[model samples]
Target: MPADGIIAHLRTLTHDEHVEVAGVGQGRRVFRVDGVEIDVIHRDLGRHHVGQCGSCALRDRCVEGFWALRVDHAGGVQPCLLRDDLRLGVSRLLGDPAGLASAVAEHVAAFTEGTL
Candidate 1:
């Protein structure tokens, strides 16, 4: 199933839902399930796309792309789809937990700044 379909099913199972489109742009949604709040980002690759790549000046304005690494069946790690030259083996990704965390933090910081 597509991500949006999965999200829709999850939303049905959840007890509550909310739409957040202010600081976070218009590409996020929140849900509460079993007393736990789950933040789900709806990738709006449609009209709200903010950039051509991750490092574009408008990177932070997008919430529909590159929220996590894509790993294939053979452990091919694709960090970004737009870059066209970024791919790491799963072993390499597993060997650098700190590096992954730092990268995630940097992206989060950028998103937060855009939201703010």
Candidate 2:
């Protein structure tokens, strides 16, 4: 299938490579190469429909968690798409590495075994 082809191609990426079969909704594959992440999106499976977000402390009632690292909107960039309060202007996001890392750490900490 197409996924097999994608896997085969991914295996060919040599040197400083780590692959994570991502467990998020739609279940993409993430290739980490020298600290950079390359995500390959696949078909949706609705896995997160009843998981992850439900268990996260940062969310409130069906709010999606970790669906995106950052979303670029017409207004600005948002750390979490569902949370308007987390919005950050491009310059702010670029300038605040500590804030970015904290946000990412919080999201990472929220990921459960079912969603990791």
List TM-scores for all candidates, in order.
Answer: 0.40, 0.35
Candidate 2 residue-wise lDDT, 10-74, digit = tens? 75883444433344444555676666777665443233432445555555542334456565655
Estimate every model's Cα lDDT from 0 to 1: 0.55, 0.51
Global Cα lDDT for candidate 2: 0.51
lDDT value, residue 89 of candidate 2: 49
Candidate 1 structure, TM-score to reference? 0.40
lDDT of 1 by residue, 8-58 (tens): 787679759876655323356678889887767765523233223424554
Q: Local error of candidate 2 at 97, Å?
A: 10
Highest lDDT model number: 1
The numbered model that scores best in TM-score is 1
List the candidate 2 regions with Cα displacement exceeding 4 Å.
Answer: 1-3, 15-24, 44-46, 50-66, 76-116
Task: Kindly report which residue stretches of model 1 are placed more than 4 angstroms away from their true locations once superposed.
Answer: 1-15, 21-26, 36-51, 54-63, 81-84, 99-116
